[model samples]
Structure formats: structure tokens, C-alpha cells
Target: MGDGRSGGGGANRPAWLQQYDLVGKIGEGTYGLVFLARTSHRKCCIAIKKFKQSKEGDGVSPTAIREIMLLRETCHENVVKLVNVHINHVDMSLYLAFDYAEYDLYEIIRHHREKLSHSINQYTVKSLLWQLLNGLNYLHSNWIIHRDLKPSNILVMGDGEEHGVVKIADFGLARIYQAPLKPLYENGVVVTIWYRAPELLLGAKHYTSAVDMWAVGCIFAELLTLKPLFQGVEAKATPNPFQLDQLDKIFKVLGHPTPEKWPTLVNLPYWQNDQQHIQGHKYDSHGLHNFVTVPQKSPAYDLLSKMLEYDPRKRITAAQALEHEYFRMDPLPGRNALVPSQPGEKIVNYPARPVDTTADFEGTVAVQPSQPVSSGNAASGNIAAASVAPSRSMPRSMHVVGMQRMPNAGISGPSAAAETKRSKYGNAESWLSSTEEALLRKPNGGHTCLFEIA
Candidate 1:
């Protein structure tokens, strides 16, 4: 097996990770670092999310805990699958192994914008929107609300094959809706600023899945137009109303929103006093600005508008949005139809997340997922993504320093090669060994145990 100390401050490096060959850095966020790495046993591609360590004796943040717990149970073709978690006792860090994918939607959009015209074919848009809704539907059905949904959070795997699927990747802000329960915290605003729903903008104490729908609306508009629907310069207000005549701009083209048309307009807690503003009027700018900025709207516009409804209660549900006429007008084709088989690799199967270990690893101090630190959605919960400690509970955000695929020759033994083979084939058994299992059982020498089979 490959083993070596990486980076300065060797004290922070995990003992076991030395064996895996570091390929390169894939991404970086506030919480921790993500690296594309290959183990000695398999040539399989795996994305390792390393969490940062806190002084809390290898503990992870809370947000990571919810993400892990939910991912462990919710597996679907539309959602990214978290394969396995590794924790090392010596350095107190955690590593989450996920199935590697080709690229993210953000990159694809950016690439297409440069090579092709700003315009995108309707077929591609249809496929993407359908996949997005399907993933959202699955999440909502399980009573899990993905508080933060955006283009970047959607992941695409495989190459130009119809079977290549799009999966929703992040669950850092997801939560189960339960009445009469302890609030995670007061005023938790979880979606990205641009994709954030208006109700959330108004600081609504209790929100629902509609917030996600708003993000879908924003994404749809951006995809159709190749630009964010509500892109605007940040203003100084805490409630974060758009600086320009954004609302008016949307109304003139899509049609005006009057008290009679949208009766709930008067009810929003933070509804602006129009007369007090510069316009001193209702939608004087133009509604068609949205349509004018973009090309002609396909049949999809009708459905997209509903998801972007001003009233949270009136907004479409993920399930309802999936069944909307826009999607029904053009259904998603089978995987084989969209992307044909490539030369070397076989098609990826849906629901590819590795099964949770059933062994009794109660005493073992496996790493735990962490929680976002800030109250609203933007702050990554307490868990840093890059780490590998037995006591770590969550993945901490790490700086995505850099990544490279390790060569086959780097592996030393047949046993190691076999392990790598298992990983490539998605075999769960290869994740840990009998000795590792014994170590897991004793995660912490003594103290109340937190790591349990999900």
C-alpha cells in the first residue's frame, strides 16, 4: 500500500490516508477540502471529502450529521450517493468517499456558454429540468426538504451517453419537517442568496419545501437564458430586496401581479410599500424585461412561473412541478436514448451509494458529519469537510488544494490491487477489514459513544 506524509504540519495528517495516492484537488469550500484520490487496491475513482478538526476532541459539526444521516437513508437515481466514511484515530479527521462524477452543472453551463451560442437546445433543457424535478420529488417524498438547491449542487456523471444521469449533490441544509419540535435555531435561512425564496427573504420563521421550488424557478430561467434569472448587485438591506426594479421588470412581460390576481400579496410579512419607493407605482418598468432578456419561452415557461410564484403557499411542490404540463409536454427519454454507450466504460447505475456497515461498531470512534455554523443557509454547518479522525463526527470544509489520479504501478501488492478492484466495482465489503472493524469497535477508549450504524 502507498503511504507517505503529505503537506507540512505532519501532526494533522491521518495515519491511514498515507496509503492512498493523492490525485489532485477537485473543489474547496469553507468547511473542508475535497480531493480526487485512488487507493492502492483499486483504480476506481472516489471523491474524498476531508473534514477539518476542531479542538473538541475529534468532534464534527451538527449539519454534517444531518447530511450523512439523510444520505444514508435516501438513495435515488436523482440524488448523489455518499458511499462510505473513514475516520483515523491518530489525527482525528474524517473522510467521506463518494462515487466520482464527470463534472458539475455550473461547469457545463459555463463551457456551453463559451463554445456554443448563449442559447441551449430545448432537448437539453428538457432533460435537465426533468432530472432536477425528479430528484426534488424524491427528496420531498421522504419528508426531507433540501433548504439549499442550486445549479452548482446538481452533479452529472458519465460522458455523452443517454444513461449518464444528473444527481443532486449537497444536503448540508436539508432537514426533516416536524411540528412541535425543537427548532434547529431561530431564523435559519438556508438557500443561496440568489436562489433564496422571497418568503425566506422576508425572514419567515417557518418555511417549507417551496423555498426549493423558488430555486428551481431561478435555475430554469438561467438555463433557458444562460443567465441567472434574478442576478443583481448586493444591496445594504438585511432583508435583501433587489436593488433595481427587479420585481417590476419581471411583471411587465409575464403579466402584472395585482392584489386581485395574487390575493396573498398583501399577506407577506415583509411586503414592500410600493408608494414609499422611488417608482411610487406598480410595475411601471416592464414585465417583459425577463422575456426580452432571454429568447422566446418554450412551453416550459408556464410551469416555471408557478414554481416562482410570489406566495410560498401558492408555489408548486416538487411532486406537482414534476407532473406539470411543461415536463409532460416533453418527457425525459431513457438513459440509453439520451447517451449511448461510450468506448471504454459501462453505464453507471442509479442509487450507487454504498450500503451502511451493519457490523456493531458502537465503541469505534468513527468520524461523524458536521453541522453548518451560521444560522442561515450560506454558512457551512460546524463540520469542516477535510479531515480523518476517529472521533470526528462530520466532514469539515477544506481548501481544495489540488488532484491527480495515481498510476497503477504505485500499488505494491496483489492484496492492495484486489482492494482497489473492489472499490472500482462498488463492493462495500472492501471498505473495511476485520482489523479495521476491531478498531472501529473501540472508536474512543471510553466515553459516551456517538458513532452508530445509520
Candidate 2:
């Protein structure tokens, strides 16, 4: 839409919908409906995404247009390939075609969660982690930021050796940072709450590809633990701009964000509010190091630390993460995610992910009007929060970048002058400490943090 749109017009090809036989609806969410279809001529399966038009007479949404533009330029094995596009002239329905993916990281993680005995092996974990980063590296290298990178959005091939190949799917939330037509945040919130980067959560206007790195950190943690690192309820956008509860959840683990630690912390629009919310929790790190139960004494912790660094600028880029000692150690990450079994180890044929042929997607937000949630379990309060329909939230990360994006300096973050104007926290010695170091340094009584570095 902003000079990047290749404009794949559907004027010439009429009756495009007739070409593929709709097998059944695969999925539906924020973007639109995904149908499993087979080409009439080739007989191979393909995914057809029917883009929803605005009900208020607005032609096609810019988000759909942006997706078409970004996917047109992005060509990588790790990224989903845009196969074909169709536009009905009369009703003006826009549809995008893609190769069908059999599994998403969410399904894989949930499968292991469901079956304790069928836990993913160590080599499989490393391979999936590596493939995820490899795809992410390709995206960041091209100056594009995948604003939304949760487990659900990362797809996996389901057959042969290619079955292990992970593909970065759904560009509806992805934006190119090539050359700027406007500031990144001008488009508003881009990422999902659980995987959102610290800078975005704190209302940083001009963010970098490090935002994607932060999400990668969360995904990496989920791969090891099978649960989100910082799973918190999203704050209502209109009533309150500040996400206190979410910030509280993060500080409970990562400790407080300060100027000494993150020079640009004070410059965030919501910094003072975050400071207030995270105040009493300082030095009260709620033993989160014990929660990230990954392999002990491995380089995995080091890589994760860099990825989840409080300062977005300090977070590991996808490229740097790939080269870290974690990937080099013990069971080196195999090219295929489905690693061969050892001599005596029994192979677990992890079942192919289930595809719901008749799942209803008409109602984006579903309320069990008859069935009420039990007040006894407070954890179930946020269950329906994630189901909110995706709307026209313009992402800040979409602006075009003229040059290659590089990691920022540790002191002042991605952009020094842009974020930190004056030092708010004057105590410089506190900079010597990190939250992870404090939590993993020793056990308070009998509980030891299993992720303690050697």
C-alpha cells in the first residue's frame, strides 16, 4: 500500500474460486477464514485464505494489502510462500492461496502437554528451536519485523524429512521496516500480549527488529517449558493505555525496569506507570528461574538471557542466537526437526496435528452464555480474552527501512537520543546485577532453581 504493494490484480483471471475444491474449513481467526482446498488440475492441497472486507463500505483493508505486499517480496523456505491470489470483481472478495501446513508450534506444544510420557526429546527441541530462529533470521535480515510470533503462527510441514521444516506463516501482522513513511508505533499495537517485547509494552514509539527477537525469546522458552514465559491478561485498550497487570507479571520474574539497566526506560510514555506498578515487587523476584525448566548447565540459558534482555536493544537478534554456543553444544541442532532415534531409544511417532473440518469461525468472540465460569478458579478469568477478533490495528513496525537493521548498543538501546533524554535512576552500581543472576545465584531455603548456569 505504501509503494511496496506489487498489486497482484485479479482482473484477468475470472472465476478463480472455481479452480480449487474446498475440502473443508481448516481455521479461522483475526484475519479471515482458512479453507483446505485441492487444485482441480494438480490435485495437490492448498490453503485458501478468504480475506474479510470491512462491513462499513471500506474497500479491502490495508492490513490485507500489506500482507500481500510483504509476502510478494519475501521468498524463503522458512517463510510461507504466497502461491496465488483471487479477487472477485462483483463482490470484490479477496482470497490468498498458500501451501497447506499440517502443524503449528501450538499444536505440537499442546500435544506434549497433554501426554507426559510423549514428551519431546532433547534433539527434537534443539531442531525445532533452530528452525524457528532460522526462519526468523531470514525475516530480520530482510528488515521485516514479525510483530505477532506466537506458537500458533509458526507452522510445520507434516510429511517426510520436510515434516520438520518450520514455516513462518500469517503475514497479516508482519511489517517491513525498509524505508520509513512514518514512525513504527504510529500504526499502534502490533504484537500479541504474551509474546510482546518489553519496549512495546512500555509504549516505545520507534521500535526495531529487536521486537521480533523478544517474541523469539518467549517462543524458545515455551519450547522448553510448554507454557508461555510471561502469560498475562491483556489490558483493555480504551480504558487504560498502560498494561499494569502484564507489566507486573513480567517484573515478578525479570525484576524492575530502571534507567541504569535500560537507559531508555524513562523515555517510554508509560514508564512512570510501569515504575509505580512494579515498585513493591523490586528485589522480590518471585523465583521464576525455577519455572524455566530447561536442560541444566547448558548454553541454552545464556542464549535465552540475551533474547529476553530487558533492553530491547540488548535482546539477541535471530542471527546472533543461531551462532550461540547453545546450538553448538551436545546434541547439535539437526537440519531436520525429526531427529533419528538413538540405538536403544524408542521413537515416539508424535501424532499428526488434528484439523477440524467443520469448526465454526463466524463468531470471533464466543461467549458460553449458558455455561458460566466458576468463580473458584481465578486462573480461568482470561480464557476468552485471546479470542477477540483481529481488527485494523496498524503495526508500528511496518515502515520501510533504507538500510540493513543492526542490533543497538547496550547502554541507550536501539536509538540513543530517541528514547533516553535524561537518567532517571542515578544509582550506577545496581547496573552490575541482573535479575536472572539474582534468582539463580542461590536457593532461598530448600528450593533450587534448576536452570542454574555452571
Candidate 3:
């Protein structure tokens, strides 16, 4: 998907590669690299995530399979949509295509903190948080738990009908939590250190969606203060070592958890075993107000405190938080997070994401596009006009309200093997048929709009 000369010897390139024009590389992580591209016919921008081979070198990575399976079952405006899946029989490489998001919370926060030198508007912050919670509530209701919820994973659409809408991306570490065959702990450590919940730090064998809420709390604080609430150094020890520094950071600000505050404090694996580290630790519990400047009784402070509660059981749920006084206050949450909610409010123009044209799909140096794509934003740097068609509308009938669970949402049965059989791009129907049974399954279990003034 380049100007036709990028990814080394292209003598046997898959025909599906020609459907899109490769724009540049947008992101990279432990799983794989993400590339920006435009559909050849529709001219719509999309993000293609290329997964790395499993460590066993046998087939597609389990993370890729899990992401695809879970995404297929979910359909929400705030959730990232998996547009298509492609494979290169030559290398058995798997690529997942999704709608391209021009801005993410990480970049938006950075622009305000480092470049603009200002705090994010209250209206913007509330709208973004509301959307995030709405998306998360939907997942939790369906028995899905997002193990990781960081700023970078929260994406904002650009220049389209969905423009300014928040889309939660990255499902690599997500899981269906209802009656998991194995304990959730078997999955080992999850979440980034800074956003990790106290229960996770204390080595709780059994946890709930509260872990995700704690992360949302951290993200909310960062949105206001322009910095991580807990900036602790992570230990490099293996086999899921206890994060002493992270715990220490939390305790210093929130004060040490007591049996009175959290009745189950004594039951945690680390609470008693790591006594030497916990004993004699004196911290000022009143320091939360120091970092976050809202009034003690303000709805904002009240919601933040509940979210950062040391007791996971006491933590606020996404549905409850959506109705909190913080969101009901003036400048209520809106559909478009980027727009100003009140009249005479100055708009905060966020910079577009940076694209690196040097790397191709195979992680090799590639020739840049002959012409600069016309990206609507002038601040989008080098990238121009990467227009996209309107997002496909998901039927309202698919929407589930209240608490409903998916019975067989958990991954079961043997892993699907990446077939060595070479096939043409048009053979996707057959390829899907071969793997659909292994990947698709049913499970059991269980947002408002705001108008913006022009």
C-alpha cells in the first residue's frame, strides 16, 4: 500500500495491498506497528495494525486473535471498529484495519501541557470523560473488562461525521470476566504502573471492573492537572513482583489503607506479607486537594475521591459516575468533546498527530508518497487531505441497556492455526469460513447527547 516501491522486493505482493495507499506509520507497541493508509477507491483514511508473530513462531499471536474476537462482538460509537482483516500468506502476517483517529487523549493532553501551556477546558474534559465512561459502561455491562485504559488508547476522530467523538481503542489486554474458566489473576500483571489500582498492587487474586475505574480516575486527574496522578518507578523483577514504589506513591497521597477504611485490607496477599514495607509509613491523606485544586465539597473533587478510593468495592461504576453531580453541573457533557459547550467560549485548537513516512509496513525504510495527502488541518504537519467516508451507522437494535451478560464470551477451544496454504486476496470469504467457528461465540450478561452552540 505505498507508491508501489516501498516494502523491498514486491514481485509477489498480495493483491489486497493495492486497495489502499500507505500514508505513514502512526504507532508501534509490543504487539506490532500501526500504519496510516487511505482506501484507493473511497479515499477514506484507516489505521492498519500489523501483528507480530507469536513467540512460538507457529501462527498469529493470541493478542491479535483476542482483540479481533472481542471487537467483533462489540458495536458502539465510542469503541473502535475493526473494519477488515487481511493476511499475507507469504509470511502469515496478520493486519487489522480500523477507522483512522487523528487525535488521542495522550497527544491532546501533551499539546495543552507542553505546547500550549494551559489546562484543558472544563467542558472538554467533562465531555471526554463522559464518552469514555459511556463506552466503558457498555463493555462492563457485556461482561468485558478492559485491563488497560490509558490516555493513548482513548482516540478522538478527526474531520468527519464522527469528528470530535472519542473512540476507545486497544483491546490487546481486554478480557471477558464473567465466570472465566481460569482466575483473572492467571492473566498476570495488567495495566500501566501509573494507572494501576491499589488492589492490583496489593496482589489481589480476585478483582472486578473496579481496576478499570481506578485507571479512569488517574486519567481524569491527569486531564485536569496535566500530569500523572501517580508517577512511580516500576520494578524490573520478573514473575509479577510487588510494585513497592507504586504502592508507596499511592499511600503517600491517599494515606495508608486501614481495616476500617477497607474491610478486606487484611485479606490481600501483600498487606501482611509485605508488612516491613508497609509499617511505619506515615502519609498526609489530605494531599489530594493539593494536586487537584477543586473545592473539597465540589462535585469534581467528590467524584475523583470516589474513583480513587482504596477499596475497589467502594469505587464508582461507570454507570453511576455518568450520573454524578460533576457531569450534571454547568457545561454538561456533550457528544462532541472538541467543541465549546458555552457561548463566547474560545475554542481550543488541538494539533494533529504526527506521521513518520520513513517506515513501511514491514518496518523497512520506504519511499514517501509522491504527493502530500490533503489532511484538512493545517497543523497536521506534512500530512494533508486524508479524507474519509462517513462511518457506517450501527443499528440501535444492537444496543443493550442496563446489566446484561454474554454467556460464552470467554475464549474457549483450541487456538486457530494460521494456514500455510497460499491464497488470493479475493479468497477472504473462504478464509473467514475456515476460522469463524473457532473464533465466534455467544456469551450472556448485560450515553446521552448534548448540543453545542455554534
lDDT of 2 by residue, 155-267 (tens): 87654335457789988877756433247787777788888887888788788889888888888888888888898888675433356677777887777777898998878
Q: Which wins on lDDT, candidate 1 or candidate 3?
A: 3
On lDDT, who's better, 2 or 3? 3
Best by TM-score: 3
lDDT of candidate model 2 versus the reference: 0.63
Residues 1-454 of candidate 1 have per-residue lDDT tens digits of 1433222223333444544555445565555666665555665556667666535543554455556656775667778878766665544455666766555566556655665555555555666776787778766655568877877787766422213467888777786653333343363546776787665654455677788898988888777777676664445464443333444334444454555756665654445544354234455434433452433365576677777787777888876765565655433322321232223322221222121211111112213222211111122332221111223122111111221212333445434544543445333222223323443465552222234332
Assess every candidate by TM-score. Answer: 0.66, 0.73, 0.82
lDDT of every model, 2 decimals:
0.53, 0.63, 0.74
Distance (Å) between predicted and true CA of 112, model 3? Answer: 0.7
Give residue 357's error in model 2 in angstroms.
2.7
Residue 421, model 2, lDDT: 18
Candidate 3 residue runs with Cα over 4 Å from true position: 6-11, 367-454
Model 1: per-residue Cα lDDT at residue 136 = 83
For the record, the alpha-carbon RMSD of candidate 1 to the native fold, in angstroms, is 15.7
- Alpha-carbon error at 286 in model 2, in Å? 3.8
- For residue 286, model 1's alpha carbon misses the true position, in angstroms, by 3.0
Give the CA lDDT, 0 to 100, for residue 160 in model 1. 26
Give, for candidate 1, the lowest lDDT window spanning 10 residues: 354-363
